[model samples]
Target: MEIDRLTVRFGELTAVHDLTLNSDCGEVLALLGPNGAGKTTTVETLEGFLSPTSGTVRVAGHDPVADHDLVMARLGVMLQSCRLYSAITPLEALRLFASYYRRALDPAPLLERVGLTHRRAIAWRKLSGGEQQRLALALALVGRPDVVILDEPTSGLDVEGRLLVRRIVAELRQSGTCVLLTSHELSEVEKMADRVAIIDGGRLRAVGTPAELAAADRRPEIRFSAPAHLDRAALASHLDATVTQPEPGRFILALEPTPAAIAELTVWLAERNIALSDLSTGVASLEDVFLRLTGEHQPEAKGPGQTP
Candidate 1:
């Protein structure tokens, strides 16, 4: 799958801007961004639901819009909204979708793989949100697609549901299917994705593997929870580096968290009689990289109802 210099516009609003990305078979490339970041628009173009205003998007070496039927045959999509009929049961829904593909997996084994065997007989409207999500995944896999797009696969899922999805993703990777995943679950993305593309304001910001992105910002730092409204300037002066409170009572010191730096921080807190809690040292996290890249105060992962 490839998107080369892709741009999509909705009249006065530009939803995507010269975005270029590609995914090879047997890779999970995650598209990470807050709401309104053009993730849905990009995916829609790839699915042939929307045409690019300029540039190109291709799935299986065919232009999605011009060759919509051929692209749909090889591409499986699970959008944020469930696409199954309300009255349809999981088993029935999978069978119906499977019939569309010339080569398809059996509904029974697909149901079991997604841990929906117990709920296979339940009506789509009667199944829990997590159950419905798993069923959607099963439908996507029924076609044995060359590329699959999963939006918020783990949203509202329980621990067992999450584990089931993770296992299935692993199996898909082993089977050499290209997977494109979008989610707000940063920790999960860090675990499942081979590469992550962070975008904001309808433009690409950064793209790399979890470790590469984290290591991109080489500065190590200490994070601790303390009373809110502390004097940041004084702390910065003492540490001789930048000090930031990403959230109230949560502080980050942009200095190497070496033994000496840690000791100095402790002594400073001791002298000021400030209580400290939850102190730890680490390099940048995927979450930290996302926040820095997007500059969003609070990144909310929701369906792009407000997005153009």
Candidate 2:
């Protein structure tokens, strides 16, 4: 898959600016961005659901819009939300979707692969959200597609369901399938993606492997969690580094976390009777990089059972 200077607009609003990216066979490329960041617009263009206002897009060397049928044959899409017949059984739904493809995988084994064999006889509406997501994934694989586009593939999944998705993705990579993914799950992206593309305001901000992007942060710092009311000035004086508490109980020290520095910190804390619950020295995380690039405040934690 290749997007070269791709631009998509809706009337006067440019939803996607000049964005260029490519994902190769046997590779998973994750697209990361906040809402309304043009990730959906770009994916829709690749799926032939919308035409690019300017520039070009090619999937498997064929234009998605101009050669929709050819591209559709090799592409499997797992949307975040798709309505299935309320009463359709998982087995029945897979068989029905399988019939649409000339060269489809066996629905039974596909269902098994997604860990839905036990629930195959249950009605679609009777399945839990996680079960439904697994069934949707099975449907995507039934076509044995060369290119798979997964949207929030693990949303609402439990730990076991998430592990199943990871295993399937690993299998896909081993089979030399090109996978394009979009998700807000940064940790999963870090684990599964060969490369990650960060986009904001419809423009590509950065594209690199997780390590590469994280290592680009030259400002390495030591981060720790301790008492909330630690004297910032006193700590800074002790460590001879800049210190700030971005949040209650979380503090950042702008200094290279060398062994001597860590030892000094531990000694200072020990002398002051301050209990350090956690300490780490590293480059910024993907989430931190994302927040810096997108300039958006992180939302409060979600309640249990939230999709993301």
Candidate 3:
């Protein structure tokens, strides 16, 4: 899938601003941003749910808007809100949806893969939130689509539900399905995404692998046991490090890039004969990078049909 200069506008507001991105076959591209960042608009435009005000969206070499039917045949979508008849059983729903496609996977095994086989005979509305989400995912995959667009597939899910979705995405990748997913859960993206795009205010801020983003924002931190009344200012002045208090009796020192921060920290502590405990070092995470790039505030979560 390729989106070049895609733009979507609603009256005076532009939801997506000249966004360009691509997803390779069998790759998972994560759209990371807070609510109202145009991630949903971008995905919806690519899936043919909405036409772009300007620019082009191509899925599987076909334009989504111009070739709606042809593109729909090759694509599957799992949006945040999906409704199923309350009276229909899980198997029944899958079979009904499967009938619309030229080719589809068997409903029984597909239900099993999504961990809904036990509930295959149960009513759709009787399933839990997580179960309903899983059924929606199964419906999306039943057609064996070449491209899958998942929007908040794990929203409101428990830990187990999140794990199930992650496993299903991995299986989809193994089967050579290109996936474009939007998610607020950093850990989920970190685990499953091949590349991540940070979108804010309807614009792309950064695009790279998880490791690359982390490395780019790398900062070393030091932890040690100190007196409860230890003068943070004095310690910082002495070592020339920025100090942060994460908790009572716990301090983190951010060091400069001259040398290994840990090495310098160790020497500074040794010179003062200060005993350190639970000392560790590591790189920044996607969440850190996101916060640094988008600022600490989270955008308001908008409901469907609301203009971004």
Candidate 4:
């Protein structure tokens, strides 16, 4: 999929401005942003739901709008607000959509993969929100599409449900399927995404691997504990870095983790006759980059490997 110099305008407000992005087969390209960041608009344009105000958007080398039928056949979209028959059972719904395609996966295996085998006969209205989301995922894959667009697939899911989706994403990547994932889960994006794109206020902010984006505007962080509280004003005069104290005797310094920098810090601390402990140095994380670029506070991760 390719979006070259694309822009979307709603009257006088520009929802997207000169945005260009792409996703290669066998790769997961994660689109991340704060609210009202034009992520949905960009995805909808590629899905052929809305026409672009300017520039080009294509899927599988075909114009999404001009060749809607061809693109529709190759793409599977799992939208957040996907409408379904509340009275239909999971098994019945999967089979129903399978019949619409020339080739489709068997409904039985899909039900098992999504962990909905026990609820196969339960009506949509009887299932919980997470269960409904899983059914929607199965419906999207029933057609065996080449490109899958998932918007907040893990939203409202329990621990087991979230793991199931992560496994499915890895499986899709191994099968050489292009997956466009959009979610607020930065930690999950860190683990699964091959490339990350961050946008804010309808403009592209940064794009790269998680590590690359983290290093874009960051310094290595040096965190240490001291025997006593260091004077913040005097420390500023001795170090060429930004310092923060979250605790009485703990200090975090933002600077390059080079040999010279470490030597300077050690020498300075020794001259002051202060004992340092728990010293560590590392670069920023994807969440750190997200916070810096989008100017938003980082929320706590849902769990160790689960993301929402």
Q: Which stretches of candidate 2 lie over 4 Å from their true place?
A: 226-250, 267-274, 297-308
> For model 1, what is the alpha-carbon lDDT of residue 72?
88
How would you encode candidate 4's per-residue C-alpha lDDT over 1-308 as one tens digit per residue? 99999999999999999999989999999999988999999899999999999999999888999999899888888996776898999999999999988899999999999989999999899999999999989988998989999988888889898888899999999999999999988788888899999999888999998888877756676767886457654664566466666445666666677788788888988998988886877756776677768876422212222334
lDDT of 1 by residue, 1-308 (tens): 99999999999999999999999999999999989999999998999999999999989899999999998899888888776798999999999999999999999988988888888889899999888888888888899899999989999899998888888888888999999999999999998999999989889999999999988965677878888866767777777766777667877777788899999988989999999987977767898789889886432212222231
| Residue 249 accuracy (lDDT) in model 3 | 55
lDDT order of candidates, best first? 2, 1, 4, 3
List the pairs of residues colliding in candidate 4.
none
Per-residue alpha-carbon lDDT of candidate 3 for residues 134-247, written as tens digits (9 for 90 to 100): 999999999999999998989978888899889989988999999999888888999999999999989998999999988887776554556555566666666665665543
Residue-level lDDT for 222 in candidate 2: 86
Candidates arranged by TM-score, highest first: 1, 2, 3, 4
Please provide TM-scores, in order, for all candidate models, with all chains considered together: 0.89, 0.87, 0.81, 0.81
lDDT of each: 0.87, 0.87, 0.83, 0.84
TM-score of model 2 vs. true structure: 0.87
Q: Which stretches of candidate 4 lie over 4 Å from their true place?
A: 223-280, 297-308
Can you give the lDDT of residue 34 in candidate 3?
A: 78
Q: Judged by TM-score relative to the true structure, which candidate is superior, 2 or 3?
A: 2
Residue 129 local lDDT, model 3:
83
Highest TM-score model number? 1
